[model samples]
Target chain A: MTTDLTDSILYLDAVSVSFDGFKALNDLSFVVGRGELRAIIGPNGAGKTTMMDVVTGKTRPDKGAVVFDGSVDLTTQDESAIASLGIGRKFQKPTVFDYQTVEDNLLLAVEGPRTAFSSLFGWRSKVTAYQIYEALSIIRLGDLKYRLAGSLSHGQKQWLEIGMLLAQNPKLLLVDEPVAGMTDAETEETARLLTSIAGEHAVVVVEHDMSFVRALDCKVTCLHEGTVLAEGTIDSVSANDRVIDVYLGR
Target chain B: MIKFLFHRFDKTAAYFIAALAVLGVLIPILNLALPEASTFHIPTYLVSLWGKYLAYALLALALDLVWGYCGILSLGHGAFFALGGYAMGMYLMRQIGSRGVYADPILPDFMVFLNWKELPITWYFFDHFVYAIAMVILVPSLLALIFGWFAFRSRVTGVYLSIITQSLTYALLLAFFRNDMGFGGNNGLTDFKDILGFSIQAPTTRAILFSITALMLALGFIVARAMVASRFGQVLASIRDAESRTRFLGYRVENYKLMVFVVSAAMAGIAGALYVPQVGIINPSEFAPANSIEAVIWVAVGGRGTLIGAAIGAVLVNFAKTWLTGTFPDFWLYGLGALFIGVTLFLPKGIIGTLTARFNSGGKGDTA
Candidate 1:
């Protein structure tokens, strides 16, 4: 629990955020090492999503330090700025550019100059094309690359969203409920995909499915009342009396 | 350039440009080269009227760029158009020197009538055609940049943005109506004598202006098409569909919106500049919010996102308005309202969108 903030790719120290009278995050602190994968499990209102929002700059923490890549303060940056700083986030619900082709969605997310001027003159370069193809293959969406994202099935859309993150090639990825509406087989495939992505980028996956968490086979953090209640291996965290009483309902 | 053109213009766009080109050359030839006795001859008055429609077409195209592609739904687009017209009108007013009814070389007739001792500083350098031309592009673009910066940065969107844009044009309408504003007050800028030393009422001038209007519409179409076809356009489409997703992808959404908004305003300004010379007047009525709403209708009826369709809708609607007003002036408003309701209920995609969808589906069925 006492990790060096400078040694981690993402360091969140004593972050707290409140909405009106409700505390979404209460003195939450955690460190994600470079290329490490962490699974967050909690009941409703445990602030798992709020923690992502704070780190991704969607919401400002009332008090805490969010440092990315060691020295960059994420609190002062906006969503686009934070994204450009090599932090990518996938929403709980699949959100893709519905009208655009799957390939164009990945193309838009591909790392490069994000200014209007650059986009105006942008053409598909060899490297970008290669990256897109690589992402498409990884997500098993290569054949549906030309199809409209809206037309894809729910699982396919989820994969396309993951593919978009891969195309971005961020140093850290925040994936929220990637398999929420997916089939069991699709969920297994997604677990495999996230495992493969872990060594190249730090991943913070927030999920509700214990089976899915076990499938990820990564370090588990159980949050309750806006703070971490347990942290250890999945077996240990699930075995904790407080985590089971509050979340598992044994 | 040839490769660029081929890549940018789809078949429909190519045909749209070709039609404009043919009309640009043919209409002038029919008016100027043929005698009035010949059936082929296009009367001077009709030429000017159609020229006005082409100008409206360009305005509608400008609106479509922001509303259809970017989902900005600007209801005050006429403000930019009217500003461009006023810029051209100021030059025309200056051109009337020594030839006006007041015959004042230093002041326009309206300024002289109001007994202004000196020309307003705003009117300075408007005497030069080059300055006026620069104002035509600059004035609207400047307004759009300032307006879009505030609106987009604040993330004002949907019907709320539409309401503000409507208020923007309405505010301009009121300001332009004030005589102290020195823009000819409620009467607006009129009494033009010439442009570039040619008689404004001359048939040759009318034909040339008509040709220019057609060319400008073609140019506007080409420019809009190029923007929407580029990766920039794809980003705009994404912003329209999923704005937050686009932001998460690292694009400065406000910057993209502002860029297109400014470009679209400039195009609308050019359309207004072309309109004034042919219409022989520029007035505060041009700034009426209703005028902007009608332009949006033209885009919607033709197909909101299709550049060619915007032009087609503008001409079609205006042509109908002319005929209906002449026959049943009292019923024109009702007719327009009914038409809009009918299009929304039966053809939500507008004329071009529905037709293209049908054609595409039919093609797919044949393959299947």
Candidate 2:
């Protein structure tokens, strides 16, 4: 099969995954273009999270190829290898190391020698420090850098996880439900942050809040039953009869 | 390692090193310089016992490196300790030369008793102290590397990993008890004459061994402290707190586990090598799963993540064990059981953790 290599950073061709004979992903073909920000909106069981799992190499598709950066096959790599290949995923639930300080959380996520030997003896350079500082300012957790991540509020924890994702400096970022538990103000801030991040790196955000999606103001893809139901601007997609029926009909 | 120690010397770590240094100096003086009749003088037997305790502390420190830091709870650590002990025991056995009961130049007495024709090929290079020392570190590390590679790569963790580790030590126990294993079977290795040409029973040698044990404990603490303070240590702690998160952050979690597991095993092996010389014997009992469990309890009681706490837990619990087993005899195990239960329910953070929380929070407890 001849695949278009230059247009997209990630392409999933008819990807299908089943768990114990139950289809979680059903022949879902999708693509995310380079340096593009895409918002995925869907109902509870529309397979949004499963689609993310497939991209992050957390789950394998029984059929179809997940091509990354045009030529790299994501299906052939494990989670760590996929992560190291410049793809970072933020989970739906915030999962920061609660016991460590916020600064340390960022440090652990920093791109450098990740091996045991290097960490034991590796020198932290000026560039690494500057990157951590930049991340801290981006996440707005500079004042609480020394505080344990466990002590942070839920919204703050979500931001910290996002900040950690930023620290990885990946070419692609898969953020799942970033504003799920966030307040209105925090959600708006996240919208701005992710929007600003999109131009420098390709970002795929799976979110539910329509206002937040409107705030994103990017190309929106509405999913239903593990396939793309609608793809357009926020207003256009929301105005689609099919998209409206899929959200309200079920 | 020294750089980290000097740069990151905190109160807890500093106290640990100071205590070791003090003990190292005072014990040698009390046993050698001070008159035996003086109340301040330490008896020779007591010195050896304390030396054994220090070695146990080192073992506990090693356990804390993996368990407390990286969250790999290995209950088969005693097997590594015993393997290192056996390596040292082999060298000592060779030192016995013609002094053994059978007086065989090459074969140890137990091998002669078992009617073996010659020294087993596995025991060949152990006659050399350097080779024995190398084996003392290498054998346990190699075993840990292989075991951790399989276990971590398969994503076996928590209680399942603990169970497999326990099974490993139990397996070693059974094998070492077998006559055909060529490790002296049920009797194991004992009746040592010398180590590196120094008389094993000499007071000066015992004092030297005690000093060496203390030095080793200090160095182990420094190395472990430096490790946990490093950036690598940060990732390890993250893994302990959230394994999948660390994995998705681009860390090869299994490789990290294997590395720490092998390092901890090597440290445990060194502790065992020091232990055999001070205790003058190496037996299959050292490989008992219960011994490993007791070591875990020591870490729990002292506080798991605190390196100094583990060392303190080992020395204090073992000191109490020596005292209680003498006075109350059968009550010792019950006391230990109660302590474990009490620590779990009331002091989940253990002694050091609780104390630190109090100190840090000014007794508020919430900050902890």
Candidate 3:
């Protein structure tokens, strides 16, 4: 059960998970408020992705509570059920149905009747059309709507996956390394796209690129081991002695 | 319903149906109406053989519905096919009434030979044609429902799922071979006298059955095409490509798999039901894992994801088998192996797929 946490859209208190005797997330507590865009930065094994996994219901925490929208307990649900509750996750690698068209990828990801019969009958609605249109423009792939997703370039595929998340209409979006291998221009466009989306949705981004984090210009949380090591403005977190010692090679 | 059926209709499917319809009508006319001495006349034996191929094409189409579209490779589809045949065989045995060598009016010849005094309780409703048809559909679908529920619920997929499906058919094969199981023991059910009071061996009856088989194949193709053209089909393709991603996008993957699997099983059952009468036998040999694998090969040779391709592959491969076995019996298996290898190497997309790629659209991008 979730305790009333009005200030935060998501509340994770003392969440921990382990795999094969190795603790991936240990005593980690975090929160994201409604319509707030937050950035999480960490080294390779600092439990950044594991936290996303826990929030998205892909991996169950060994102990603790994950409350979403103030009261909905995310850990109690499975991946699809959790998604139905308006929580979306973008994987580190851009994963779309490669054989399908870009428009079809968004249409399949649209928030609607997820059951077999409803989808089989007719899942297309006005709302879905509007969302697909919006997503195509957002991802800047309007002309490529009919193109197979597999044929898209690497950066384009990344944008298409983001478009898929937008079509989902999620309340809280967990984006992992969204600009890992993008061109400089593509990264800049992605930053603008994500920034524009912030005021309407709670977006939590995890990345290793310091420039990208600075471009986001949001409150930053730097993780070390399995807990928050520093939390503040980008400059302040980067200036922290422990962060400089453990993450940024001095 | 009409709109939905026509919605997915394309040139390939249209041509497929046109070909089947021509064959359906012309085969009966050639075999029944024309004199046997005429060059245009087709012999009754060839008509029955082609009918068997049509039934097999239906089976391959059913397999393609799941394996090709949904990516659920079932290596035991023959089990469903065999179960359907057994249901039809039971009804045919009942039609024998009082014609057995032992002169028993109630029991079939095998039961009479075994000195059984009464029919088994499992055979209760099979005496009626309607009930037998229902069983032909229900029995396979029921088995698929139960099996798919447990396997998909637990997320057993890929090669593991294929292996289990093979094991399922093998287990059924072993069970049906036993004499005490009441399915005529190792001999299985055969020597059916009539169906709906029509003589089983009559040319007119055979023609009707052949026409029915062709019609069923066309219907199955249409249904499969409509499904793949729907939103549900998109979701299924997404599941096949990236299952975990589809789940994260909010689809109950197991339910979709279960629904398609059950539909596929019912189609296979119907194929089997038609097969028994045309081939004049139903036996445990139908449950062989090799037969199921052969069905997979047919789909692969036609085009794994293309419904029309699968049907064509089934007929083409079976025709080759019949020809090779008769003309060069010793080289049949080796030729079959080479065909599979050649398809894997040069025709990876299959006969129809490669042709479509070359003639229709050049790019990999599918038209909306």
Q: DockQ for each candidate?
A: 0.64, 0.67, 0.66
True contacts kept of each: 0.78, 0.75, 0.80
Model 1 superposed RMSD (Cα):
1.6
In candidate 1 chain A, where is summed lDDT lowest over 10 consecutive residues? A120-129
Writing each residue's lDDT as its tens digit, candidate 1 over B58-140 gives 99999999999999999999999999999999999999999888888979989889999899999999999999999999999
lDDT of 2 by residue, A1-250 (tens): 3456557888988998888887878888878889899999988889899998888888988998899998899998889998899999999999999999999899888876666666667555334678999999999999999889999998999999999999999889999999988899999999999999997899999998889999999999988888888898998999899998888342
* Off by more than 4 A, model 3: A1-4, A125-128, B362-368
What local lDDT does model 1 show for residue A89? Answer: 92
Report clash pairs, candidate 3: none
Count backbone clashes in candidate 3.
0
Ranking by TM-score: 1, 3, 2
Which ranges of candidate 1 are over 4 A from the true structure? A1-3, B365-368
What C-alpha lDDT values do all the predictions have? 0.92, 0.90, 0.91
Residue-by-residue lDDT tens digits, candidate 3, A1-250: 2333767888989988999999888899888889999999989999999999999888999998889998889897988999899988899999999999999999888887789998777566445477788999989999999898998988999999999998899998999999988999889898888999997999999999899999999999998888889999999999999999999878
Model 1, residue B178: C-alpha shift (Å): 1.1
Most accurate candidate by TM-score? 1
Stretches of model 2 off by over 4 angstroms after superposition: A1-4, B363-368
Ranking by DockQ: 2, 3, 1
Candidate 2 local lDDT, B1-368, one digit each (tens) = 45666776787788878889999988989899989899998888999999999999999999999999999998999999999999889899998998989889888888888898877789887779899999999999999999999999999999999999999999999999998999888888888889889999888899999999999999998888877887778888989999999989988989888988999999999999999999998989999999999999999999999998899999999999999999999999999999999999999998998888778898554561
For candidate 1 chain B, which ten residues in a row score worst on lDDT?
B1-10
